[model samples]
Every structure is written in structure tokens, then in C-alpha cells.
Target: MKPIFKLQNRKLIVIFGLFIIAELGIEIGFTFVSARTGFYFVLQFSILMATLFILFLIERSMNRTKQELTKNKQKLQNIFDTLDVAIWSHELSSDTLLITQGIEKLYGYSLEQFYEDKSLWKKVVVPEDMHIIEEREKKLSIGEPITSTYRIVRPDEEHRWILDRGIPIFDAKGNFVDFTSVLFDITHRKESEERYRSLVESLPDMIAVISRGKIDYINPAGFKLVGSSSAAQLIGQPVKAYLPAHVLEQIENEREEKKTFEFMLNRLDGKRIDVEMSAMPILYGGRSAHQVVVRDITQRKKAERTIQFMAYHDSLTELPNRYRFKQHLSRILNSEGDRTVAVMFLDLDRFKIINDTKGHTVGDQLLQKVSQRLQNTVGDEGMVSRQGGDEFIICMEDISKEKAAEVAQRLLDVFTSPIAIDNQEYFVTPSIGIGIYPEDGTDEETLIKHADTAMYLAKERGKNNFQFYSPELLDVSSRKMELEGGLRKALDNQEMILHYQPQVELETGKLVGVEALIRWLHPQNGLIPPAQFIPLAEETGLIVPLGKWVLRQACEQNKAWQDAGFPAIPISVNISVRQMDDEHFLGSVTEALEKTGLAPRYLDLEITESIMQNIERSTDILSRLKELGVRLSMDDFGTGYSSLSYLKHLPIDSIKIDKSFIDDINHPSNQGLMVKSIVDMGRNLNLALIAEGIEKEEQVSFLKRNSCAIGQGYYFSAPVTAEVMRKFLAEGFVSV
Candidate 1:
């Protein structure tokens, strides 16, 4: 297309030329115009047209350049609006503000509003930060670059943190034109700083930061630990002042390797404490430094020491226990002190009886006093240690045979003085056994074993005296160990059997019941009686499982007899106190009856009178048995702590008069009177009275006279096999 400016210029040229020509023509025709006048008009008109067209071309080019500039400016603004940061420019002369769309997103205002209100930036500055903004504005006016962090209150009344960086713009003559600023929302960053500061301040453990070998930061807790009232007191001090010598040397490792360590800290107040610490490299004040965390471990250290002590020492007596004692003895024997050193093993005589009769609390008090006396008697003479239970050991150094005997005698003399405990006076004596080094045995284990054996011998020889261990005692010790091993294998070896003895009614001479007796038929030792292994079982806690086996066998045999069309007589199974105390004793009994298909009534549990010693526990256990429809009998009545007071509280169906009273039936004494009284007691309680050890017919007659109905003794029949009992049942009688 031709230029519109060109077309207009061409028309103006044509008109101007035509007008001039007409003017010339008119002049010639009328001879009224001169040549100078026409020439001047044409030349002036040509000059005017040339100047006008040049102005039109220049105006058109300027308009096109302005449109291109507008398009580029809009594109730049769109790019700036998408940015998260706010960008703005201010004209110095007019105070006019030009801002991107991001300004509205930041301040909740439109760009037009910012332009209309020149003071919008100043108004948004929070009151507290207004001075900072004003100071930065002054910097901008001075053509200086400035950066600042300040709080701004948005139009919606929300406060935000902003980091503003502004650079000054200058004209050609160095006059300030305007300042451009970029603002980044730093609200989240500021909040995170506050939270981090709060956590560091509130920590219980001390935290510190070290920079350039100086303490730059410390938490409040760290200040208190160092006996300082404020961080100012410790900051800028050499880090070595607070750290231990060794830990100070390890600081480099902590920084480079992130090492954690423990040290004994030296406080400013001249006190020492245990501390655990960790250090890692971190940025502090824009410089690489060490950040350390420390924790006070003084109490934890004390607890650790306490646990260590308890592990090796007896808690009750506060004396070195078996483990610690062995350690000391082993060390002494391993060294050169072997010639004259003596190891003495001591035990309190009949301590279990004291515990059971006087109650464990009193027994504990008695043991404490005994331990004190032992300690006093052996003061500076040697070390005394407890070997658990009622047993104790004394190691005497540099003592000859006679001196060792003297020490043992001194120990015995200490126990002669009765000690009072719990408002009651009790006498406790120690049985001491001395095993002299190089004489009794060599090593610690040997010496300790010999001493223990001698202690047992002393007890056998009527306790309260000390005796030296001899080679002869070793034989007995070996036999006892061998017996224990055999007993452990008895159950698995099928070497143990239950023999049932008939219990006959004195009134009708008819068999009424049978008591199950456990006998060990050893492969080589022949028959072993209850007197031998029963006590061992009680001591070793084997009685529980052994008694359970007895119950099972007795229940099965009695059930078999009843199923064979014989009279169902209750078979009594003897339960040791150990079995009664076992947690699963009832469950074992129930399982036995269930497996045997025996009626609960036909299974009788016979407990000794000692069960009444712990009457509360016995009551609870016996009541559970009663609920199972079983009968309970107190075996060996009139023995132990068989107080009639406790007897009335027991859940028993029968009371078995002990053999001792029945054995005295023919004596010319009041023996029958005691039996009759027990019989009368049983009658009053509606309990059956059975006599034990009725070996004579006169004893049976005496029991009949005393109204005791059931009698079991050798006169009827000794403990026999189940088949023999079955034969007796078939005959419906027993023969001596």
C-alpha cells in the first residue's frame, strides 16, 4: 500500500503548482503581476511542502517505535507478575509507583491503587519497623544500594516478614531518578528461626557453639551448669575453660569426625561431674564453628555404681556375696598368700526352723544381727562374706592353724551373747568350718568345697563350734553328691514305685483307706527309705515334681481298684510343703484325676501339721482343693506347730493322730489321754480320726476306745505293691 502521508503530500504539491501557474497566467494576461512576485510565491510554497512531509515521516516512525516499546513492556510485566517475589519502580520526581501484578498478591492491593496512593509502601510498614524502612529509603535517595528485613502489615491486617533489597537508579548528571526494589516474603523463614531458638533455649541439656577457639553461644542451661548467671559471663571465653583437658584435645575430632564422648567435667565452683557430649561442625554467624550438646550424667553415674555393687554384693546383709567372695578368694589363692590363709565356711544352726516358726520378718532381723556380730568378731582379722541363705564365709590372712582356730572360737563366742530384735530376744549361733591353705586344699574351689564339708560336719557334731576340715569329710561329700545324681535320674529310670498300705477301721476291722508311700528302688543301692531322699527332695525343690508323680500313681491305682468291682476307698497321697507351695500344684492334681478317671472324693491329700505354720496360705490352697470335691487330711497330727487354734481353721476332713502318741498306748502314762483328746477334737469338728504306726493290737483297741475309727500300721500290712493291695481288696481284709 502507498503511504497515506505520501498521497496527501502529492495532492498538496499539485494544488500549490496549479495555484502558482494560474497566478502567472493571470499576471501575464492582465500585465498586472511582476516576475519576482511569482518566483517568490513558488519558492516559498516549495519550502513549506518539503518541511511538512519531513515532519510527517518522522511522526509515523516515532508512532511505530512507541507501539513496539509498549508490547515489550507488557511482556516484561507479565514475566515479573509470575515471579513469587514483588518487583517495583518509583519515579523520584513525581513519586509515581510502577509495580508488577505480584504486588497485589503480596499486599492485597491492585497496581492502580499503588499508583493512586504514593505512600502505600510507607503505610504498609509495620509501626515497629517504620524507622528501618525510612532509613533504607534515605539510603536509596543517596544513590546507595540497601537491603533490609522488616515486618509489614498487609491491608487485611495480617503481618508478614519481608526481605527488601533496593538499588538506586541515577540520571546522566548523577541525580537520583528512582529506586527499584525486590521483596521476598520471609514469614516462614522468620517463624522457623523463632521455633529453632525456642527449642534451643528450652532444652534441659546444655548446648554451646564455639567459633575461632572462643565460646560464642551457650544455652541458659549451659550457663547454669557452669555456675554463671548469664550467657554474657561465659561467652567469648576460651572453650577450654569449660571443657576437660582430654575433651579439649578431642574437640578437633568432634568437629571433623562428629565424635561423641564422655568426660569428667570441672565446674567453676570446684566441683566435678560426669557429662556426655557431642560436637559437630556447623555455621554460626556466617563462619564455620563447632556446635556441641552436653548432658549432666552425675545421677546416672551414681545409679550405675549402685547396680554394680548390687550385682556383686548381697543386698540384705550388705556383705560381699558368693560371687564377690569367690573373686577375692581366687585372687588371694592365686597370689603368694597361700601358705597360711584360711577359708572358713559358717552357717547358722537350724535357721530354717527360726524362719518358719518365728516368721520370716523376725528371721530376717535375726540374720541381720548375726551378720553384724560376725562382722564385729572378724573386724580387721579377715573379710567376711555371705554365701546365700544362712551360710557365710570368712577368709583370714596370715593366720597359722592355731590362730585360725582362735578366730573360729572368737566367732562362736560372739554368738553366745543373745541379740534382741523386733522387741524379742533370740539366740543365733554360727557353725564354723576352717579349711587352712596348703593343709585342707590348694585352689579356691577346693578350699571352698572343703570348708563347706567341714561346716556340715560341725553341724552334725552339734553346732555352735568350729572344726577343721579333714580328708575324711570328702568321702561323705562325694556320697551325698552321688546320691543326688541318682535321685535326679530316679524318675526317668523307672526306679521309683508307690506302695499302698491299708487303713483299717478299728470298729469293724474293715479296710477303709490306703496311704500312698513313695519308695526308691535303686538299681544298685536296693530299697531307699523316705527318711533318706525326702529331706533331700525338700532341700533341692525336687519334692514338687516327685509329689505330683505320687498323686498320679495313687489316683490311677485307686481308680483301677474301684473299676474292678472293689470298694472305692480313698487313697491318701502325701504332699510335701514344697509341693503345697508350688504355684501349679492344684493344676497338677486336677490333671492327675482327669487322666485317671478317679472321682475327686476318692483322692485324699495328706499334708503335715507344719502346713498350719502358714495358716493363711494353707487355708486358701486347701479351700480350692475342697471345692474340687476332694478330702484333706492333716498327716502327723499333734506334731510341729499343730496348734488347735490353727487346726480349726484348716479345711481338713480328717486328722491323723501321729505314730508317737499311738506308740505310747501301752505305757503306764497319760499317753492314751492325749490320743483321746485329739479324737474328741476330731469328733467335735465332724472329722474322722485315723491312727498311724498301730503296730500292736492293743494300740488298735486303745484307738477304738478313744473313738478313733481308722488305723494304718505294719500290723495290718506294710506298704505293698498295687497287685498285693488288689488281692487284699479281693479278700476284703488285711493280714499281718
Candidate 2:
């Protein structure tokens, strides 16, 4: 469409042309007709009519143009109304602002308000975003295009995000004329962005965006994860600064796919931490980049290490366990070359006695001390491991039997000095046995077996010593195994028998009681002594049932003699610590007495001084026995290191001086004095004294002189069969 000014100028030119044409026509007619006959007048009238007609046509065309312009302006207004955008124009010449009706939809203001007050649009802009409008105005004054985004608050107190874009118009003289701008409502888009930012900021794991190998954006979690105080500290930093070169290369190589990796992350604080990272390709800032999420796994890694350590090491001593020791031995044996590998099997001597008496807490402490000593004694020479209980196995490669022996001696020597546990000095000793590779059998099992056998031999040969594996040791081990097997079946086969030893009054020469002793008569091996099989029973845990059998048998036999019209006498039955520790021990004793129809007063339960180790428990057990109307005597009284206070508290009717003291009672030295002191102490405590293992008359006389009344030994009669004991019972007295 043409401008109004141009249209008006065209009309004026047409009218002027028509006037010139009419004047020319009149002049030509006057010339041709000599100014007569009204010819000029007629010509002027026709030209004037033609000019008027042309003016009419021009006026009609201008009307049609105006109509079209109006229609087009209406269509543009409709288009602006359909979109969520407001269009406005400012004319610098007139100082006027023209805005579309859509301005009401965008700013909650009508066109009239904007026209009445151009500053109203500026006032609606949020205070923080007013700077954007000011900057855009400055750019527009310089004839520069304006494109800005800012927030605005409408008259209804509602906030909105606006995207304002404009193009500056200029005049022919290069002076700024006006600017037409379009404003779009972007509140929804801004809300979405805020939600996403909120989600990222609140996450516990780190989120980062990388562009061009540098950190483009990082969440709050990322800042904390990398030990950065602010975004400025981490932004624009190369991803390579945090990630290792290999990790970056891996991420770059697989940029198109999502992947996770676990590695040590170097923190900004110079501490390395375990981290799990997941990376995926993303469009950051409209360019291909990577988005990574990181999690710290330092605690998880530490827990894993702890679990792994627990799997291979003993919890109590922190030493390699039996499983680990076997693994070490197998590894050495598998790769053994022309070198001698010595496996030393060590068993703490009498460790069970200490463990049972002193309680497991002390036992555990002792074992820990032994483990530390073993490690120190064999430092760098071998690997020391606990084989459960008080047993330790050591492996030394490229060592000779002599070297092993020397190491074993060092181990024994280390324990020679007392170990201090809970303010108490304990004299613990180790009996170590050495087994050589290729000589003491080939494989781990055979070598360990040989070593164990030699250890038993060391124990048997008066403990606190070390011995090397020999063929002779295997024979002894085989005999022991045979004895253990035979002992298990002895009770069921009725191969066990009891012998009664007379307990006589040393001064009166009268038999008062008899001690029941267990004898195993192997069907094939003849009679086997208690020393040969009793320890085997205890080691195998068969003593609990065996002691019950002994108690019942002694009770039944004594009852039989009483029913047979013989003299009534109490029978002594030995009780093992294993039986004492049994939970049903009291029940067993009750059952034996009830089933045998034996009076409780005719029975005596013999306990050794070792019971004093657990004084409280011992007192309770002995007090209960005393309540059952049975006599309790402490056998081997002086051997167990029982304190005088312990003896005072225990409820015992008698104290049997152990044979070790009795054998030296006649000697003219401190030996007799020791026995005399024990007798005197027993007398003062109101405890009956009985001397065991008295074989000579002089020993008997010395015991009688010391006021020890009761005695049992060869001096009376050896442990006799029940049939022979009946004759002794009938005889009633033996000549002392």
C-alpha cells in the first residue's frame, strides 16, 4: 500500500496535468477559430469535465486503498491477540507510544493506560530487572537491536518473566527515529527451569555439566563434593583437573553411551577419596557435552576392607587362622623348590588345664600373648598362625631342621619368662615340634600330621621342649589313636573294671575307706593302665560319661558289700574337671545314688586341688555335694597352687596329701617339713589328712608322727579287685 502523502501528491500532479491540458486545448481552439463562435469556450468546458472525472477516479482509488489498509491492520491485530505476545512502537518525532490490545494480556494493562503514561510499562518491570530495560534503551539509542529477558510484576501483584526483543529504526540522516518491540510471556519456561535447578541443588549426589572439557555448571552438591567454597572456584575448571587422564579418555571414548566407573577421586583439599561416577552424553548450552553424577564410596570401601580382613584373620589374636595357615602351607608346598620347608606345630603345654581352671578370658589373653611372642620370635623368618585353641602352626621356607630347632628353642625360651596377665604372672611354656618338607612326608596334611605327632611326643617327654619329626613319633601317635578308639568302646563292651584301694588309719592300722580306680582291660591288649587311657578319654571328651560310670559302679559295689553283711565303709570316687563342668553333673550323682540304693554317707567324691582355680564355682559345687550328705576330699591338695583362702572356703571333709609329698615324708629335710606343714594345716582347719602312695614303714611312721591318720598305698594293699577287697574287708584291719 502507498503512503497517504504519496497518494495526495499523485492526485495533485494529475489535476495540474489536466489543467495544463485544458488550457492548451482552449488556446488551440481560439487560434484555430479566430476567438469567435464560442469554440474556445466549448473546448475549455470539455477539458474541465475531463479533469473533474480524473479527480473522481483518483478519489475512488484512494478510498479503496484506505479500506485495504484498515483490513490488513485488523488482521495484524488479530494475529498479535492470538499469540501470548504484545507489540508496541514508539515514535520519537511525536513522543507517542502505540501498543496492540495484547498488551493487556501480557502486562495486565490496557493500551490506553500505556498511551496515557509511557512510564507505566517501565514501572511494571521488577526492580531487579529494571536494569535490563535501561540497558536495552541505551543500546536502542545507539541504533542497536535490543534483545533482553527480564522479570516483571503486573498490577495484580503477579510475577512474570518477559522476553523483550526490538529492532531500532533510523531516519535517512542516520539519527534514531523509533523502535518497535515484541514482548513474550516466558513465565512457564522460567518456572520449569527453576524446578530443574531446585531438583539438582537438593540432590545428595554431585551433578556436573562439562562443555569443551571445562566445567560449565555444577550443583551445590558438586561444590561440596569437590571441596569448593563457591561456584567461581569450580566453574571453568578443566574436567581433567578432577578426573584422571584415563578416566577422561574412557568417558570421551564412550561419549555416546551411558557408563559408570569406580575410581579414586583427587579432591581439591589434596585428599583422595573413593568415588562412583556415572557419565552420559548431553546437550549443554546447545553443544555436545557430558553430564556426570558422582557418589562418595569411601565408607563402603573401608567396610569392604574390614570384612575382607575378618575373613582371613583370627578375631581374638589378629593372627592368621587355621584356614589361612592351611592356604599358606599349600601355596608353599605347591611352589616348593629344592628348599627345605619346616612346619613347626606348637601346642601350649597344659594349656587346657589353665584354660579350664583360670576361665576362658584369661586363656584368651594368654593365647594372645603367645601369638605376639611367636610372631616376634619368628619375625620375618616365617608366618605364624593360630590353629584354634592354644595351638599355633608356623611355616618357614628355605630353613634346615637345625634352624627350625633353634627357632623352636627360641619359642620355648620366650615363654620361660612369665607372662603377665591381669596383674598375675603365668608361667606358660610351649612344646614345639618341627616337620621337614620332603622328609616328614610330602603334602601339607602329612607334614602337619607329622608335626602334630612330634608335638605330642614333646609333651609326653616332659613338656616345655621341642622335638623334630621321627618315625618313632608316628608309632607313639598311632598307639594313642588306638587307645582313644579302644577307650570309647570299652564301656559299651563291659571291658572296664574297678579296683578298690584301701584307705587305712595310719595310727590305728584300720581300714576306713577304699578308693575306686578305673582299669580298662582291652580284649586284645590285656589290662591298660589309667595313665595310658585316662588322658585320652579327657582329650576326647569321653570322661564325662566315664566318670558317671565310675561313680555309679563304686556306689553299687559299696552297697553290694553292705548288703552282703560286710563292714560299712565310705568309697571314694574320682571326679574329673570335665565331669564337674558338665551341666548335669549333680543329676548324675543323684541318679547314681538313687539307682544303686547306696546311702550318701557311704560315698566320698574326690576332687583335686585344680578345682580351686575357679574358687567360686568350686565352692558352690562342693557345698552342693556336702548338702547331699557325701564326703568331699581334695586329692593332690598341694599340687594345684591353691591359696590358703581358697582351702578355707571350700567345703571339704578331708585333704589327701598328693603322693609327690608322701614319697619324701621320711626324708630328713624340708621334704618332711612340707608334709608336716600340710598335716598341721589340715589339722588346724579341721580337715582329715590322708597320705597316699605310702609304701615304706618309715613313711607311714613319719605320716603317723605328723598326725596324718589316713593312708592308702602299697603299705596297705595295691588297688585290689572287688573279690579280693571283700577278703580285705572281712579281715577288717591291715598291719601297718
Candidate of highest TM-score: 2
Estimated TM-score for each candidate? 0.64, 0.64
- Model 2: weakest 10-residue lDDT segment is 664-673
Q: Residue-wise lDDT of candidate 1 within 1-736, one digit each (tens)?
A: 1144555576568657755765565556445435577775665566557656765675576567656666786776677666557887777877767677787877777878888887887788889988898899788878889999998887789988888899998989998877789987778899999999899999999999987778999999998887789999989999887787677777755556687888887788988899899988898899888899999999999999989999899888898999999898888777853357899999997576556445567777877878888898899888999888889999987889999998898888887766787665666788888899888877888999899889888988888988899988878867777878899999989889999899987776688888999999999999999977888888888888788888998898888899999998889999988898899998998999999999999998999877866878888999999999999998887655666667787789998888877876776634566687778878998898889998898887777776777898888888899888888898777755
In model 2, what is the error at residue 722, expressed in angstroms? 7.3
Off by over 4 Å in 1: 1-83, 87-102, 127-146, 155-158, 166-181, 224-234, 252-255, 266-271, 336-338, 357-362, 478-531, 537-573, 577-621, 628-736
Please report how far candidate 2 places residue 371 from its true position, in Å: 3.7
- Model 2 collision count: 0
TM-score of 1: 0.64
